[model samples]
Target chain A: MGSETESARRLLTGWGRTAPSAAEVIRPATTEALVSALSRRPARGVIARGLGRSYGDVAQNGGGTVLDMTGLDAIHAFDPDQGTITVAAGCSLAALLDRVVAAGWFLPVTPGTRFVTVGGAIACDVHGKNHHRDGSFGEHVTALTLLTASGDMLDLTPEGTPDEFWATVGGLGLTGIVISATIQLLRVDSSAIRVDTERTADLAETFAKLRASDDTYRYSVAWLDCAAAGRLGRGIAIQGDHATRDEVDSVPPVPGLKPRISSPRWLSLAPILRSPAISILNEVHFRRARTAAGQIEAIEPFFYPLDAVGDWNRMYGRGGFLQYQFVVPLDREDVVHTALELLHRERIRSTLAVLKRFGPGSRAPLSFPMLGWTLALDIALPAPRAARVLAAIDEHVAESGGRVYLAKDSRLRQELVDVMNPRLPEWNTVRRRLDPDGVFQQDLARRLGLTGASP
Target chain B: MNDAFGLPSRIVVLGGGSEIGQAIVAAIVAEKPADVVLAGRTPVTLPDVPAARSLERIEFDATATESHGAFFDSLFAAGDVDLVVLAFGVVGEQAVAEQDPAAAVEIAMTNYVGAVSSLTHVSTRLAAQGHGTIVVLSSVAGQKARRSNSVYGSSKAGLDAFTEGLQLASLGTGVGVIHVRPGFVKTKMTANLKAAPFATTAEAVATAVVAELGKGNRTVWVPAILRPVMWLIRAMPPRVLRSL
Candidate 1:
């Protein structure tokens, strides 16, 4: 405890590098230190940050204290027979997967980037391509420990404390600080994925294919070429599952976890991407992908292709970029079409657009996913005109009983909080009960009115 | 905190009663800045915008350079201020000022000396906080002195240079400084004078300032065409410029 010193302030932003803020970041290497640090609540309060994978301000607290949990990253125990792993909250999913896959186990749910920590995974209740079949990361958790604002450590489980567990699962780190968690791991034969790819001519075909064949595949997602105006919704549907030993002719070494090369920080392809050249580039990509089946690929490329290029966010330029990801109920598929048409009409091009079908949402009130169609896109900043289009989309989403994922948001209006997530009141009640003084807070919580009122 | 689109949530206008300052605040009313501080010599009435969460007035005299340090310290100590607008200046009539040295000095003191003093304190406070931007309202008259308004123009010239230098000094401090040069804005300052070429209204200047801030631009021209117009005007030799 005596070793701890006053940490210097750091300017932090999410993976998207937008809306950065300054906070005094303290790295607590032990649970005892983390708890002690939380006990002294600064005026602006404290929030925990992992690898800063969240796209916006979810992990930031301007003029506040940010607990850097990466220090307490020890994987305490692993049970092969029962397929359970107990690890500190600061342990990153990349570290956990490397260890588990070598032992014939896999993460039940993984987001696009494996750079996220266990604490962030539970805080956002992240969903993966296999969400329709396996559910979110929080659904697989067996037990967890939370350090409440009152300095009380809680041992929570789904069965033992449903209210506290569900609330903390997707609470956006507003309820309390998650110290450590015990997760249930899935068994896999190899660290390879058996993938099937197909090209869809337009939005209709892509939707039809995903709706028809999504059930057969354990994991499925579609990448849309939005710049292709001729075939507006043109895309490629990718589906895959963990490969069995019999399915693989020969097993290759596990792919490297760290990115080998990084995109130049000064390089900005935004101007070119915003021009007609985007249409040609996306068309070439669409034409290059051929219909193929039974292709064995490494897990790294299959799960996190962008992770191959570190600091890829810099490609959008210094102004940074925004990832607008939203989920609309399955019946409101027209909203997705409306969004694409609006972007085309406005002459705004999305560098990368992804479409997926989500299963039923979890018990957590603020959880973003539900039985719906979700579209995520990357748009460069300084496109102030994009704000109007997004606000209109937010209205449509809220009206359809859908909502934008707070994890990937930076520009959402505060008024839409209740309309989008009706369960917010319920979540806030539990959050307030846990931290009556609201000692745990963040920029996202304040920006979106996540906790209702500031402490 | 800035919104997802980079619209600042907390805004401060040093020259609170300045027409251009209020116009800029009014322009961003739709975004709903949480806190708006209007500090000037006199009590300033709230703008027409009712969507703002809180609007407060504090007494700040630009001529009172000695009190600026304490004034800014208490303001920033309250909380993090996202945007600061240094919009206090006087446009003295050159004809009346050439005969009266005291009047010329008054213009110089208010426009140049006052700005340097206030900005020094504002910049220090914002830099220490690690996040915030200061927008200084300069004038196109500062581009080159006209015999018609030499006193006012020269004062603005000093401010323009200081603001740009402060921008460089602010590098790596996480604080931003933007220079806003408006050609001719129609407000109380120019109400009795003839409208200049491409003369704009205070509302127009506000619109451009807010939009440029959103784009994270270091400098902006009110009408935008003035950028090219000023370039050509600057190319003429002093011998040819003396005819005006």
Candidate 2:
């Protein structure tokens, strides 16, 4: 570790907006180095940033050291007999998924985006289409090596240090920096996914179909047409599970099948993304998808479609986009429809509107899932009249038994967060117990008043 | 701006009828606090604070301590309160207060004991929940006992200390306590007083408080230069300072 200013200058967090002008970004390639670094700066807060996927400030800590975990990505040990893989926290989910699939294993849970790091997934307690079945990523973490605020290295799991473990699971990197994690992986037949697609006429039909069919599939999601009104919640529901090698051959080949092709690096540039030429390309791309029921699709097409587009977030332009994700309890399904109706009534266009069924919630106080339905919409920012429209949605969600996901929220009131997640106090208590001095702090944490500043 | 964090972050001035309080509330409400709650002893007849979504009223009486808890409980029970401006107090004539001990006691209780008890209850709940900020109005006149308005000054002194303690106790707790101390504000409370140095209006104090709050400061003295002046006043020998 260098001087405080030096350490502070090197921190590059996920999503360019939150990267600290870190004086020094410590990349501990090994556990010993990580431990040494922690011992050296016992009083400073450390945030572990992986792959930098969080849209806002979940992983960056200004004026403090950032432990870039990506360098510690190597898998330490794989116990095939126990189906547990102990790896460094810096490992990317995409890399983990690829390696695990090759070994007939898969992550018990994965969020929509696979580029996230294992530490990030656990820190945010990320969830996915399979949340209705498997729950959040934290649910599958068997154990984690947490370097506490006091520089004590503790191995935590659901059974060991249960409270601290659960709190750190969704603690948003406030508890301490995660050095490594041992995750329990699920066994799968093959890397391919056997998917079935169906288009629903409206919201009611979609809900009924999901309620009836979700239990049969391991992963389920709906591409909602938020612009549709009256019928309100209409969209295409796609459900799937891991495909056996035999089932993989039955599906029609995707038009462009280059399994070995690497993502083009040039696509990550901002100028190419913001040009009007890309919008036409996007329009053509949307038009190419043929609407059909019971259509079989490949796993890559269904799950990681966006992964193919390098730096897709750049499409939203320099202002970036805000991902508004909230879940309405089943009891408040009517409120969900009312909210969708209002969005449709306003004709606020969101490029990506995903609806999914959540089975039950995890013990994490601010966890985003519950026994009901969740809708996530990615709206391009700087759109005309977008603020007013989002406010209307926030009011509707508050009235219902729902709250937005903090991991994805760039904008939302601190007060509304209090209402939506009443469990925050309990979680904060745990955070204080671990970080009594309030060493850990981030932009999102500050914005949401998670950590009190030193006077 | 309210949506920046995800809820309506509006501010409401309970005593829009108050000149100094309303000016402070108006300035804060301008920064946008999601919504404004403009409750008063009676409906305030004034222009609405700009940018505040709506100004609603609930009949509030500073002297009505018993009703304070229920009134505030019901008000904040909706759970939308992010920042509350406790600007309800009375500054009666010193001669009248001296002649009528009961009136003086009422002023003392309303400004110090009554307000503290009610706000304590409110702050307790807000602290347990770990959110919301309480903005309490205090005066530099309370920094020490003054001959002109010792009764009023003493009441403010108690409030000022209580708020400072609240701020200290609330550390590590999500709830925040902001003590706003302004000097010589040209409001009804000080309208009868002779002109003094560094005299400011309610609007000016309010602007300073709102700006300082955004900077995450715990306590603020309006007309900032007065902060050093206050220190100087504190350092002066008692006999010499009294003569001034």
Candidate 3:
């Protein structure tokens, strides 16, 4: 049965497809329907779900009402001259990317998945490959239209309603149900990227390369080869900037040349899910010479390579997988070294890890990254000493003034959360003030006691 | 074409409308952005296939073998084709085949002679281009002719033999030919048949073919165990096999 229904109970999970919870799901096709659903929330409370791409419990509400935002996917207004688009929160970034990329404008910031909703990007303040230059997704948002717990509709902005705006940004969707928003898009001459790649010997060299030359490139990421026996963090450091129209002049006019309208469908990783298979893949990947100068590539391949495989989580077997991403300040790169060493010592098998360097954070108090190195590792679920390994990493992340991304995290606790983000009390105060009746709540909020529910 | 990434940069599918052809194309494109060309008689659409950086369609009729040479010449004139998937054929009803020998010849020609003509031109282009993979779709039915449908089985038998010969010739020439022998694939052609032993989905075969492509192997048997099973089937007494 379809999960977008108001009357029927539907079980829902995030992109990780783990820890599913049943909820009363209602698709709000119009603002009236959304407001009506919010006004009459059930005992378990209500949360808004958009594309269900949050990776954790953020989009689910057990025994509660979940507003499936996809029904509201529509372009309310578009101005090519101004390079801005006003769209419903439920509209997927994938659907909107087609129109923007064709027009030679792009989203200022996008996470790994383009299938997520614009509202989810704002709620999580999601960062992307260009975070070092552009910052988080919320920074590009011009305005947000929200439905509060008291049945009130409020318009907020970074400059106009700075408090409410920052709170709602990375506020974990606790402030209210996001109805719609105005977003500013970046201008580009073409959809191609001019990429430069170099393989690093170890963690030290990789960190040095990223720290020294990251500012030169609009996008930069390091694919950490965790499977390499002695060279733990050895991998490739890729940097790229959107290719200018002139840069692609060498590419002869191919008849079918056009910007990719959507990301590639998911490819299953089941065939190569075993550790041996992954190790071989990683070894093959790591031996691609030393460096490649520059090549013109499309945006999707540069930004979202894994999007090609559908249901990639299936590769982890039926037990599912967890993506543990944490960010520490620029000075504490050693904490990252310690964490990887710990994983190696534990004999925990993880494929190539993804590492990104963040520039500066935004006004959002609960924003995950803050001028540091963010490392993300995917581990098989039911792994050996899974809890102990993650807990150890979490302790180091917190102790080193680092914090885990709430959207990407599924195992953080309450007190450690406060330690990670000292501004949690302030965010909680703002959340309580905006949703005093606690009508806006979901599984994530309940799990971490963010909305006063005991964990 | 992708010397650095190992993901094929340009792929050409001979029978875009065939379920097996689309599956192989989908698998290759999933690895990375590869310019894909779909050539078929009908307009083919690959649903759920990831967004292609560039996807082109050409009207192609396999029965029109005269155009095979010029088609390959132009397709490979400007760029190298990394992989060519051959999955075009017709399996006519056995009753119609028995009633009219002309209808039976039409099916046989379309499945065997037409495929050979097209593949010959492809092999020449790939050989000159220096490197590429050619995937030919054969079936288990070709392993042992059945009483119910000997015409289709014989046609597949010819295809299997021809592709294997081509594979042997292309060795060390940088041209790879992958002969895929699957048992009872649940495609439109096999929809009417009852659930056969070891029946497989088009996607299951697609996955297996894509995995084998990585190993740079010449032949792949779907369900894998079919390799040993086909061995036993080939060794089975003709009387006992006919009775089954």
- Highest DockQ scorer: 1
Fnat for the candidates in order: 0.27, 0.05, 0.00
What digit string (tens of lDDT, one per residue) describes model 3 on residues B1-244?
3211123557888888888888888866654446788888865453334645578888787889888788888887645576788988887887789889998998888889889998899887765544567889988878888877778889999999998899888764556678899888888877887766888888988877766552233588887889999899889999889878
Question: Evaluated with TM-score, which candidate comes out highest?
Answer: 1
Report the C-alpha lDDT of model 2 over B1-244, residue by residue, as the tens digit. 1222222254545555777767766665443344677777776454566666566766777667788778877775653365667787777667788789998898798889877876787677655433456778888878877777778888999999888888887654445566888888777667678866888888887766654442222798877888898888888999988998
The CAPRI class of candidate 2 is: incorrect
Which TM-score value belongs to model 2? 0.63
Error of 2 at B167 (Å): 36
Residue-level lDDT for A292 in candidate 3? 88
Query: Residue B167 in model 3: shift from native, Å?
Result: 54
User: Cα lDDT of model 3 overall?
Assistant: 0.77
Q: Count the backbone clashes (under 3 Å) in each candidate.
A: 1, 31, 6
Per-residue accuracy of model 2 over A1-455 as CA lDDT, tens digit each: 22222232442324523212232357776666776666666333566677778876666554455677777787888877678898888888777765666567778987766778899898899998899999998999989998886878889989867888999887888888887899999997765676777777788888888888999999988877655434456677788887776766653332132223454544334433332443344345434545554444654567677766656666655445667788888877786676666655665556667888898899877677888888887665444445556666777788786888887766665557777888888988888998887766664675566664310
Score candidate 1 by lDDT: 0.84
**Candidate 3, chain A: TM-score?**
0.93
Which lDDT value does model 1 have at A35? Answer: 82
Tens digits of per-residue lDDT for model 1, A1-455: 23353467887888777776677889886777788889889878899999898999899887678998888888999998888999999899988987788888889999999888999999999999999888889999999999999999899999999889999998889889888899999998887999999999999999999999999998999999999877888899999988999888877455465776787745654444454666787788789889999899888889988788887777767777789999998988899999999988898888889999999988888888899999999887767578778888888888888899997788887778788889888988888899999898788876776777621
User: Number of the top candidate by lDDT?
Assistant: 1
